[model samples]
Target: MNREDFWEIVERSRAEVGDTRDAASAAAVARHVVARLTALGPSTAVEFQHFYEALNEESYRWDLWAAAYLMRSGCSDDGFDYFRGWLVAQGRVVWEQAVADPDSLAAVGVDPDDDMVDCEAMVAAAGDAHATSTGDREAFWAALEQTEGDDEPAAPADPAGEDFDFDDDEQMRARLPRLAAVYRPVQ
Candidate 1:
């Protein structure tokens, strides 16, 4: 799909999420995201990063999970490596702070029965922070620039010429009805 169409799908998906808290609704949303990503074909790490950023900004848990799953399924090694690196970095910060002063843990008041503090929550928090940052897009561009260096090599673009028109009322009318059968409106 073309960039505009892809973004339209993303936006519509986010709107569908709303304030949904039901498990089935969440699962359906996640499935839709996975379907969209799969249809998009091969995706680069940078592209996946952008998807994650957008999903996080919209507070779409399903989209984030679907993106993570897609990254794992299509790019196993890269996905695992990136996830592991994130986990390690988070662990280091938590552990270093805890060790430096045990009282830090007391502030959060860890439960004795709860063996490990929820790492997923920490990862999600970090993702949220990154998504909300005004400088995040600039940082991503800067990273890309640094990688390009002096060699201004032209990059290949997607071959599929289909354009996604998310704002098209007709398109939404056609798609939403079919989607509604599976995806109930978020209450």
Candidate 2:
């Protein structure tokens, strides 16, 4: 699937759940996405996984990591993975905006408990669908490796751009004033 198609799937899933968010909501969205991809056929489902991986790679930036860290009070390596998935689930506009400017996420209206911010289910949507389509998780990944070969988005050796201490208040305030304002980094 192309980027537009991938995003459309996300949009449809969000609509299926009325744009609600939280762990349960994220799982519901994942199920909807799986159903949609199943109807689209196996190859397309695998392609969707490719796009999802690419988008996650593109979003693996130090600045955006800082945004996730503050919004979630603190974020680990895996937490940031889920956070990127949540960002994609928000649809194209918010994803693009946050990617362009991490501070822009300060306006995304996070869930009160921030469960939506750690949406692990969103990251697994395409893979679950791929398994349903191919009837095997291993088969789905093999197909992805075959089709997406050199084109697959590889994980970055380091997050793009300068690294900084996400837990440090002064750095967060200086690097992402807007997000720091909304989340107010703990002293």
Compute each candidate's TM-score over C-alphas.
0.25, 0.90
Worst 10 residues of 2 by lDDT: 109-118
Worst 10 residues of 1 by lDDT: 59-68
lDDT of 2 by residue, 1-187 (tens): 5788888998888898866445566667777888998888888887888788888888989999999888877888999998887777677898899999999987777753564476787777767777886779888868877886775445888999899988788999999998887788455
Candidate topping TM-score: 2
Clashes of each: 1, 0
Candidate 2 global lDDT: 0.80
The candidate that wins on lDDT is 2
lDDT of 1 by residue, 40-156 (tens): 432322353444443223322222222222223222323433332222222233333433332233333322332222223222322233333433634545543444536543332
Clashes by residue pair, model 2? none
Which runs in model 1 stand beyond 4 Å of their true positions? 1-7, 11-19, 44-48, 54-187
CA lDDT, candidate 2, residue 26: 63
